[model samples]
Target: MPVTTDLVQQVLRLANEVNAFAKQCGRADLSQTLVEVAARWKETETTIVVAGAQKRGKSRLINALVGRPGLLPVDADVATNCHLTLRRGPVLSATVHRNDGDVEIDPEQIADYASTTGDPAKRRDVLGVDVTMDHPLLDGVRLLDTPGVDSLTLGHRQATVAILQRADALLFALSAQDQPVLRHELEFLAEAMERVQAVAFVLTKVEDSANAQALLEENRRRLATFVADAGRSSPGTAAALAPLLEAPWLPVSAKLAEAAAAQRSLGREDRAAKLQERSGMGPLEDYIRACAGGRELTRSATVVSACVSVLSSLTAVAEDDVASASEDGAEAARRLAEVDKALEELTRTMRDRRRHAVGNQFLGREVSAIVRARLARVRQPYEQAISELGTRAALERYLAQLPESVEQSIRAAWDDIVAEVSRLVGRALNEFLAALGLEPMEMDLAKLSMPTVWSHELQSEPGESAKLDLLREGVPAATMAVTIGMALAHLNPIGFLIGPAIAAAVMSRRREWEQVHRNQAALRRLVSEQFTQAAGEITLALEREVASWRVAVEETADIALAGQRKELEARRAELRAPAGRSAADRGQARRRAADRLARAGELTERALALRGEIGPAVNALA
Candidate 1:
C-alpha cells in the first residue's frame, strides 16, 4: 500500500517547522539536525528522569526496585561511572552502557565495567559505572541515571554538560542538607527544565532528617523566592524550569537498604508502636506511591507508536509524489502515443491526397500549345519533314500499334504505379515548351498522315511512253529490307551485312510513308524526355516534403520529453525528510542509559533519552 498525501504532508510540515525554527535559532550542521532527530524521538518516546544527589539513597531506591544490589554502582562517595540501562525483555540479560555503543562485560565485574576500554583523560574509556539492574519499572521501559550534577570531580562538569543535551526528563534529587537553590544546581535545573517537560524532585534521606515536613515546606518557599529572584520565576539559572518546579517533590529515605533491613530486623515490641510501624517505610512509601503515575515505559511506548506512525507514512512511498511522476510519465507516454497515432493517420491521409492529386489529363491541352508554338520556330526544311510525315501510312500503322500495346501493358500494371508514363510524357512536353516560350499544337495534330498503300495511274494514251517498265535500277518492293541492305553495302564496304542493313533502317522508310516516319520519330524522343523530367521533378519534391515533416515531429517529441524529468525530482525530496533521523540522538540515548549505574540521585536524570533509544528498537523486535 502507498503512503497517503495527508500523511506525507503532515510529516513534511512537522519537519519543516522544526528545521525552520532551528534556522531561526541560528544553528548549523549537526546541532540543527539534532533537534529534528530529537523531535522524532519525542514523537516516539517519553522523557522521564529519576534523580537524586549522592548519598541520598538513590542507589538504594534502584536496588529495591530491581531486587538486587551491585546492579548499580554503590561506592562510598562521589560515585562516578558509566550509566547502565535496563531494558524490557522476557529473559534477563544486559548490554553494556555506552553512549556510542555497547560492549559485553562480566556480571561479577559489573562494578568495574566502563562505557569504553581506554583511559578517561583521552575520553576513550567508560568511567566503569556498573548500571545494569532488573526492576519492574525497567520492564518494557528504558532507564538511565546521571552523575550528581554539582559534583566537584574532574569529569563532573563535562559529564553534566554532555548529559544536558539529552535531558528529556529530570529526576532532580537532593537532601535537606543540600539546598536545591544553589547556583550550580540551579544552573543544572535550568538546563534540565529547558530540555525536558517532565521534572520531578526527590528529597532523599528523609528518615535521617528530624523535620521532614518543615524542610519540605522550607525548600518550596526557597524555590519560590529563588524563582522570583531569577528575573522571571526561579532566579539565577533555573528560571526556565519554574513551571515544572511546582513541587514534584517527594520525600524518601534512600539512606541505604541496609537501614531498611536493619529497621525490619528490630524487636516485635518496638514494631508494635503505630509510629514505629510507619518508621522505615511511611513517608517514603507515600512519596513512591504518589510519584508512580502508572508506567513510564507505557507512556514512552505510546509516543514511540506515534513516531512510528508518522515516520512510516511520511518517510517512504509518498503516493502523491509517485502519482505525480506516474501521471507525468503517463501523460508523456500518451502524447507520444498520440503523435504516433497522428503520424499513422497523416501517412494514410497523405496516400489519399497523393492519389487524388492532379493527373496528366491536362497533357493534351499543354502539348497542343507547345507543338503549335514550336512548329513556327523550326526551319522550312523541318516543315517539309513534318508536312511530308503527315502523308505516310507506314508511320501511321506503327503509331496506332504503339498506343495499343503501351496502353494494354500499362493497364495490366496499373496498380503498381501512381500515373501512366505515356500520359506523363505529354505533360512534360508542354512544361518544357512553355519554359522556352513556345505555343503548343492542338490535339488534332497528333494524327500524322502516312501512306499505307501504293497506287499508280496508267498513262493516258496507248501509244505514248512505250514500254515504261516500273522496275529500273532498284526493286522498290515494300519488302524494303533488301533495298536498305544494298544501300548500306554501297555506303560501308566492310561491316557485316545485317549491321549496316539494321543501321540504315534508323533513317529508312517506305516511299509511301518516309515523310511520316522521319518527323514522328523525333517527336517520340521529345515525349520520352519530357516523361523522365516530370517524373524526376515530382519524386524530388515529394521526398523533400516528407523529410521536413519527419524532422518537425522529432523536434516536438524531444521538447515534450524534457519537461517530464523535472517534476519527478521534486516529489522525492518531500518523502525522505521526516523518516531519516540523525545518529547523534541514538548515541545520546545509549550514553544516558549507560551512565545510570554510578548516579547518586533518587531518580535518574536522562530516563527519557533511554526511552527514546530503546522503545523503538524493542517495539520493532516485538
Candidate 2:
C-alpha cells in the first residue's frame, strides 16, 4: 500500500501505548526511549544545504524556490557571509542567533546582520539568521544557504563545511556561463559527498549561455572523472558516491524566474507563466518535493524501528518470566540468554549504522557506479570521436547528443537500482528483525525516476507583422479618419498637432506590444529549441503536446538520500539528555520485577501484534 501520514500516525499511537504500559510497569528505560523517539519523529525535517562557488546564483535560486525574491542577502560586494536557515512559521520573522543571545530583526534588515558589509560587531557575533515565513514550500523542510565554499576567507569555507556535515541533502549550484568546471568545485564536491548523503547539481543562469547544454555535458564529464578518481582511493565510498553522478543536473535561469515573479505580481498571468516555464523552475521544484518525500520516508522508518526495539524488549521480559516459572525453565533460560545476546548485538549494529548512514551510502555509491559505467560504455564512441576530431563543431555536436544518448540508459539504470536497493535492504532488515523472532517485512521503497534533460537554443524572430497589427488594432479607422479630416481643415495647427499626437500614441502602444511579443517569441523559441534536441527521444505524436514532456520525470533519484541516522541519533541524544535514572532499593526492584512478570506475557503479545503493523507501515514509507 502507498505510504500515508495516517499509517505512520497509527504506528506512533501503538508506540505511545507501549510506552504507557512500560511506564506503568516501571520499565523506565523502554519508556524513556519511546518518549525520545516520538519527540524526534515530531521534530523531523529535511535539511537541504545550498552550497556553491561565488556568484553562482545559489542565493537567487533559494529566493526563487521559496518565491521570496531578495529574502536573503545577494549583493556581490556583500554576499552571504554566514549561514542562513529558512523554515516555515506562523508569520514572517528573522532572528540572528549568537553566543550572547538571539536578536530579533526585521526581514528586510537580514543583510545588516548576515552579510560581509553588515555591522562589523554584529557580523562577528552572528552565528546565522533563522528565518521563518509562511511559505507553503518550506513545510517540513529547512533550507540552509551557506557562504560560497570557494571563498578564500577561512571562516566562510569552514562555516559552509560545518553546515554540510549536518545537511540531509545538498543542492550544489553551478553556472552555465562558467565553463570547464573548476578544480576547486570538484574538490568541494568530493568533500561534500563524504559529508552529505544526497546531492542534486543545478546549472544556474542558463538564460545567459547559448551553449548551456554543452556546458552541462562538460561539467558532468569533469565531475564524473573526479568522482571516479576519488573512488579509486576508497572503492566502497566511491561506489556509494556513484549514483550521485546521475543526480539531477538542472539548468535554470534565476533572472527569468525573478522576472516571472514580477510579472505574476503585476497580474500578467500568461506572461508570468510563460517566463516561469522557460525559467526551468518547475522541474527544480518537483525535485525538491521528491527530496522532502524521501526524508519523510526515512523519518517514518526510523520511528517504526524504534517501535520494534521496544517490542523486542517486552518479548525478552516475557521470555524471562517463562524461564522463571515453567518446568522446562532451564532450556527457556538458555534461549532467553541467546535472545539477550542477539538483542545486544543488533542494538549495537543498528546504532553504528545510524551513526554513519553507511549502509545506504554504500548502496548509493554502487548504484551510481553502475549507471556511470553503463553510460560511459555508450558514450565511448563519442569520446573517441572528440579525441580524434578535436574540432569545436564536432565537440559541440557531441555535447548536444550526450544527454540524449544516455537518457535511455539512465532510465533503465534507475529501475534496476530501485529494485536492487529494495531487495538488498529488505534482506538485511529482515535478518535484523529475525534475530528478535519477528516476521519478515515487505520493503516497498519509493522508486525515484531520472530528471528530464532540457536544452534550449534561442533564435531571433521577425516582429514586423506584429508591429503592423499593433498600430491597426490600437487606432481604429474612425479615429484615423477624424484625425485626417481635422488636419485638412485649412491646415489648422491644433488639428495637425492632434494627428502627430495620435500617431505618437499608436507608436507607443506598438512598442509595448512589440516588446511583449518579443519576450513571448523568445520564450517560445527557447522551449522549441529544447524539444528540437529531445525529438529523437520523444515520438512525433507525443511532440504535439507542449507541456506534456515537462512532467515526465516527476521525482529525483534519492538513492543516496541519508538513512535513519538523524532520527536514531536524535533519539539516542535525547534519551541521554536527562540525568540517569534514580536508583531504587534492591528488594523493592525484585518485588516489582516479580509483580510485572505476571502481566509481561500479555504485554508482549500486544507488542508482537503492533510490531506486525509497524513493519509494513515503515516499509511503505521507506
Candidate 3:
C-alpha cells in the first residue's frame, strides 16, 4: 500500500490504540515510548529562514513571496531589528512576543515593531514577531525573517546565527548591486550550511544592477573557492554543497514583484501577471515550496520507521508471553537463570567492545593526525597577517579583530572534525550491533554545545617582557560527559551520535616597546606560541568528543539489551502466575495470551506494509 498523508494518519491512529492497550495491560515503558512519538508527530511545522547582509532586501523578498506588498517594511538605510515568523491562519493578525509579554497588533503594523526605525523604546524590548495571514502557502510552512548578517549590533548578528541552528532550510539573499560579496558573508554562509541542510541563493535587486549575470558568476566562483579553502569533507557538508552549487541562482526583483501586486489590486490583472513572471518570484516560491514538501516527507518517513521499531518490540513481548503461558515452573526458572547469564555476558562484551573501539578506532593515530593538519591550517593566516602588516598601528588593528577571526576559524575546524567523527562512530556502531545479532539502525548525531573563546584578553603591558599566561578549562563535564546509564535512559533524538566545541584562553604579557623599535619577528614568535597552546586544547577537546561518542554507542547497545531483558522478565512472571490455578483458569490465561499475540501480529503487519511504502515515497520527494 502506497503511503500518503491519509495512510500516515491511519498509522498514527494505530499507534494511539496500541498505546492505550499497553497502558491498560500495564506496559508503562511502551506507553511512554508512544507518547514521545505522538509529541514528535505534532511538531511538524517547517521553518525556512531568510538571511543575508543588512539592506540586502530580505524583507522585500519575503513580502513578494507572500503576495503582500509592503507587508514587511523595506528601506535602503534601515534593516529588520528583530526576527519575524509568517504563518497561516483564518484571519490576518500579528503578535509581538517581547521579553516581558506578548502584544497583539494589526498585520499592517508589523514594520512598526520589527524594523530598525520603529518605536525605539518598543523595539528595544521586542524579541520576535509572529504574523498570521490567509495565504495558502503558509499552511504548514513558516517564513522567518532575521536580522542581517552585517548588523552593526553584535547581538543582532549573534541572534541570526543562533536561529540558524534550528532552522530547517535557508534562503540566502545576495544582491547583484553589491557585486563582490564580503569575506564575512561567505563565512556566515559556510557555517549556515553546517546547520541547515537545504539552501538556495537568491540574487536580489537584479533590476537595479547593470550586469547581474556577471555579479552572480563572480559570487559562484568565490563561494566555490571558499569551500575548497575551508577543507570541509564531511558527509553532511557534501550533501549541503550539492544543492548550493547546482541550484539555479534566482535572479529576482522584489521591487517589481511588489509593483505587480499593487497593479493587480487596482484591477490591472494581465499587466500584473506579466510583471510577476518577469520578476521571477513564481519560481522562487516554487523552490521554497519544494523544500517544505521534502521536509514533510522526511518527517513522515521518520514516524513510520519509529512505529515499525515499536511494533517489533510489541511482537516480542506478545510472543514471550505465549511461551511463558505454556512453560512449566521448572522450565520457567531455568529460562530465567539463562536470561540472567546472558545479561551479564552482554554487559561485559559491550564494555570490552566500547573500550577497544574508543582506544583503537575512534581517536586513533589517523584522526589525531587529521586534527593536527587542521590546526596548521588555522595558524597559516595569522602567520601571514603578522608578516604582511608593516605599521605597528596596522598590527594593533588586526590584533584587535584577531579574537573574532580565530573564533570563527576554530569553530569551522571543529565542525569538520565533528562530521568525520560522526562517520567513524556510525560504522563502529553498525559492526557492534551486528556482533550482538541486532538489526542495523540509522542514528543522528547530537549537536554539541559551542564554548566561547576568551582571546580578547591579549594585551601588552609595560616592562612585562615576553611572558605568556594561558588558562584553559575543559568543557564542563555535566554537559559533555554523562553516565552511560543516564544516556541510555533518555533514548531520544540526541542520544546516538556525538559533537563538540574546544575553548582556549590566551593572556599575553608583552613589554610596550617604543614605536621606533617595533619587532615583527618577535610578534610572529608570540603568535606561534599562542597557537601551540591552543593546539593542545584542541587535541584535548577532540578526545572528549570521541569519548562522548563511545558513551553514546554503549548507551544505545545497553538500551537494546535492556529491552530484551524486560521482555524475558515479563514472560517469566506470566508463566509463574498460573502456579496453583485450576485447569479452567490456566486455559483462560492461555487464550488471553493468544489473543494479545494476534493483535501484536496485526499491528506489526500494518506498520511493516507502511514502512515499505515510506522509503520510496521519501526518495521520490527528495
TM-score of each: 0.38, 0.43, 0.42
> Candidate 1, which segments miss by more than 4 Å at Cα?
1-16, 24-26, 29-47, 76-81, 90-94, 97-102, 114-124, 127-134, 177-181, 232-239, 255-622
Q: Return whichever of 1 and 3 wins on TM-score.
A: 3
Backbone clash numbers for all candidates listed: 52, 6, 0
What is the C-alpha local distance difference test score of each model?
0.41, 0.60, 0.65
lDDT of 3: 0.65
Clashing pairs in 2: 239-365, 239-366, 240-365, 241-365, 242-368, 243-368
Segments of candidate 3 deviating more than 4 angstroms: 1-41, 76-81, 151-153, 232-243, 297-622
Q: Per-residue alpha-carbon lDDT of model 1 for 1-622, expressed as tens digits? A: 1224443344344445434433433335423433543443433223234454444555555554454555565552223544544444555554554566666665555444532222344334554343444445543344455555532232443465455444444456666554434454555565454334345566766665677778778767766765677765423234333454453565555444444445555753443444333333344443333223322332333232223323222222233323223312453344445545555554454445323223333443443443333322322333344344465454445444543443343233222222232244434443433332233211111111111111111111111112322483133432354655666677775433665465445434443244345446554543344333333443343233223322332232233233333333333343222223344543443343233222211111132333344333322221
Could you report the Cα RMSD, in angstroms, for every candidate shown? 43.5, 23.8, 23.0
Sum up the clashes in candidate 3: 0
List the pairs of residues colliding in candidate 3. Answer: none
